[model samples]
Target: MSERLTLPIGPQHPLLKEPIHFRFTLDGETIVDADIRMGYNHRGIEKAAEERTYIQDLYMIERICGICSHTHATNFVQAVEKILNVEVPPRAKFLRTVVGELERIHSHLLWLGVAGHEIGFDTLFMVSWRDREIVMDLLEIITGNRVNYGMNTFGGVRKDMNQEEIDETLKGIKILEERTLYYEKVAREESTFIARVSGVGYLPKDIAIAYCAVGPTARGSGVNYDVRRDFPYAAYDQIPFQVITSERGDVLGRTLVRVGEIFESVKIIKYALKNLPEGPITARVPRKVPQGEATSRYEAPRGECIHYVRANGSEKPDRVKVRAPTMANLMSIRHCLLNQQVADIPIIIAAIDPCLSCTDRLILLKQAGEKEGEILTWEELRRRSIAKKPL
Candidate 1:
């Protein structure tokens, strides 16, 4: 009988860029069990949202995930706009769709680079990131910022695409489409790349469905679901694109799905830019949201990002909740890790493209017989961190 050994990775480790802990129990070189622990970087963004006005909340929400800033902000406004009963202008809707798809391209390219680095394919990493800058530059041309575009508002978008910007964007998209095709070819034909990830981190379709995984993590396992097509938002109903999926249920499968998505995003952006409607960019909306509750779902670059808001006839929301895609996809990580070799851990985890910052949350526990849990103030939380206090 082989002796079982336990291996711990992160909260802080060379393998992880974020603060997440994972313990893997191994029998020889093969993993037997895996456990995940989060909460290392909780910022209490949801609780803070309740105290701020709608406009203020939008700014903070945009910062939730630097990579998915527009995703968070767009979803937040969509929920609040539902309660306010205002329809976004057709032109603004198309503009939002354009920015959203550009962000998708940026995110998938970033993931491809990271995945390449994880498997020691630094050349692929470099070229994918080089092409990624093209999208980043296009985002800056349209919204004046690369990371957080701040393009979304309550009734409409904040900026309109001028003729010069539109021409620049179409030109950039042409370059990106050609570059992504090259990546697809590499991911499909590179012998070493395929050998490294082809059979690693297998997550069957049934297990993925049972674990409620989302994004490429689920699609890679043959689950035909995508929020954009399943529940259209912004200009998606008018935009024509296909949901990419794979039946391989492994790291290589996820790579194929993301590459396919980049092509689809390029298609969506081209269609939106060519068919932009002529209308006002912003619609007048009331300062306060009506008393009601609503939810918004956006197909972020990672997966489905959901935002919930409840209002009580005030400038501030009564409650705010967010369900980031990482939270849903993280559930399947342990399953993927089991029975895999230790050397394959990084690429397997990277396959999900997790943003731990968006997944972590503050959890307040109550003692026995206590009906309510104590809430910690910002000052108290800061002080505890400075003093190295344990939760």
Candidate 2:
């Protein structure tokens, strides 16, 4: 009989910067059964949205996930817009698509860097992130902010891209396109990078569909469902681009899909810039929201970000729920982790691009044998760490 060895793989793991724990039941070095535990960074943002007005909830939604901040805000505003029957102008739609594509560029690069770091490829991480700054610089030029570009309002965007800024942005997109091609070559042709990812964490299309995987996770598994393509919003209907997918359904497959997506985003951005209509950036929206319920979905960096809002004819929202892509994608972890070696856990998890902060409340739970011991709040964890260390 094989000895059953239990391993706790996070809450604090070397590969993941986020707080998530995976309890792995291993037969020697190969995992047999895996259980995932999250909620390590939940801020109760969904429940808190009830207290804020519709206008204020825009900012609150943006804070849900730092990496996908604009996407979240865009999704939230779109939901409210649907409820109020507000139609954004053509120029605003174009600008929104431009901003969304730029956000995609930064986010894909960030994921690439983290994936590299997970596999001990610091050179790739550094190079990818340095290239990512070009997009960030472009975003800063247009929106006046790098990470959280608060561009979205209920009716349209707050900022406009003038001719000079448009010219500069086009130049930036060209540079990014060149860099992305180089990164793609490294990911595809380089043996070390390929070996680290290829055939690792194979998420087949059938299982991926069953688990309701989204974004690159689904695309990697030969599922070509993108919110931009399926349900076109903003200027996405007018934009020309392909939804990149792969048949391999492994870590390497996800990498290829993301790299392919970077190229497609460049195409979409260029199209939007060339055909961009001249008009007002935003439209007039009412201060008070009508009593209604609406759902909005967007192709976020990770996957499809769905926002559902309920209003009671008040300035404040009655209920708001954000279904981040990671929430759906995280469901497939068990299927991917089984029968894989212990060392591959981090890279595999990173491939899903799990964002704990957006999905769950961060809580620390202690276990005594098979029974639960005590639930430690994030506050208690901080206090314990401070008590242990004299800092």
Task: Compute the lDDT for candidate 2.
Answer: 0.90
List model 2 lDDT by residue over 1-391, tens digit each: 8999999877888867787888999999999999988777777787778888877889878887878888999999999999989999999999999999999999999999999998999998999999999999999999999978999988999988889999999999999999998999998899999988999998989999999999999999999899999999999999888999999999999999999999999999999999999989888988779999999999998999898999999878999988899999989978888899988988999998888777873333454566756679999888988896564
Model 1 Cα lDDT, one tens digit per residue, 348-385 = 98899999878875543354897776679999878878
> 271, model 1: CA deviation in Å?
0.4
> What's model 1's lDDT at 214?
94
User: TM-score for every candidate vs. truth?
Assistant: 0.92, 0.92
The residue-level lDDT of candidate 1 at 296 comes to 95
Q: Runs in model 1 with CA error above 4 Å?
A: 361-391
